[model samples]
Target: MAKPLNLLELIPKRIAKWEEVEGLVVILKPKFSHPWMREHLLPRLKKPYYRVKLDETGSSVWRLCDGQRTVEEIGKILSQNFGEKIEPLYERLSYFFQMLERNRFLNLTQKDQSSGQ
Candidate 1:
């Protein structure tokens, strides 16, 4: 997993399909964290779910992780929509993505690491 970046220039991808369940974003957890969980006991048992409830601000930011927009771009949109500056914008956004990434919700994508922009 990527560490909490000092900047938010990387692209991100959702790990799996998620759905809004009663206003919460929920993802299905595979039956097994280890292969043995599936093979030893719950081979046929249904998978459980992981739900993340987002407040207004988090929901707005979460909705923007469409696997295409760079985190910086999303920060700009947040600035425009909210009509105020998000100082240390990239750092905050990077932390958000890093949390999600660590929890297996998403991952960042970067093609050009040398771009200092």
Candidate 2:
């Protein structure tokens, strides 16, 4: 049997700071550590890092990560926002989320049990 989808896992949310720089909105976490710190310094440096550029759609999705909403919720919202072109919206949003996770722009957290109000 195929494994059941974990709703929380599928649409995890995280807190991130957003900035508009050079005509692009950048998303980043304030606590990410540098890879070269431990080897170069006696005490590892824990400076803030900003490395991801948020496109229009990405900026929209990033704005929705206000400690609320699930992946499914965001997907539905995007679907409605895009109307007949929902598939592309869904695909883009999913791709953006995956990229953010991979680049450590934010840390994914399980959705709370309570449905968003």
Candidate 3:
């Protein structure tokens, strides 16, 4: 039997590369799901990719998810920057990560047990 994952120990890695515009994070996702549609229809649209814009706090969180930091570490960073604004941080952070993962925005992987850090 496999053990359940510890939320704080999981590392969230961004699946799609994003860009920052006016201090906001913009996730550029391909509009078409099929390769044929993308090749044919994507060029016809005004924009090839769908831009998912994120708010200031969200942008900060998104930037911090670089595959290296665990959820706990991200929470600490958020606490330092947002302080009281991010009160009840862990619950909200967990929800945000869950939502992102469900939407295929990120991949949460288990931290390596062998690497002593």
lDDT of each: 0.69, 0.62, 0.91
| Per-residue alpha-carbon lDDT of candidate 1 for residues 1-117, written as tens digits (9 for 90 to 100) | 876643466787788557776665555555456767657766565554444666555666777888778887888898787754555666677787788888787878874557753
For model 1 the local lDDT of residue 105 reads 79
For candidate 3, write residues 1-117 as lDDT tens digits. 998889999999999858999999998888887999988999999988889999998999999999999999999999999999988999988999998898788999998878964
Best candidate, TM-score-wise? 3
Model 1 per-residue lDDT at 7 = 46
Q: Assess every candidate by TM-score.
A: 0.67, 0.59, 0.90
Instruction: Name the lDDT of candidate 3.
Output: 0.91
Between candidates 1 and 3, the one scoring higher on TM-score is: 3
Candidate 1 segments exceeding 4 Å error = 1-6, 22-24, 27-32, 38-47, 85-88, 112-117
Looking at model 1, residue 39 earns an lDDT score of 71
Which pairs clash in model 3?
A: none
| Candidate 3 C-alpha error for residue 72, in Å | 0.3
Poorest stretch of ten by lDDT in candidate 1: 43-52
Off by over 4 Å in 2: 1-11, 21-24, 28-32, 35-51, 114-117
Angstrom error of the Cα, residue 29, model 2: value is: 6.9
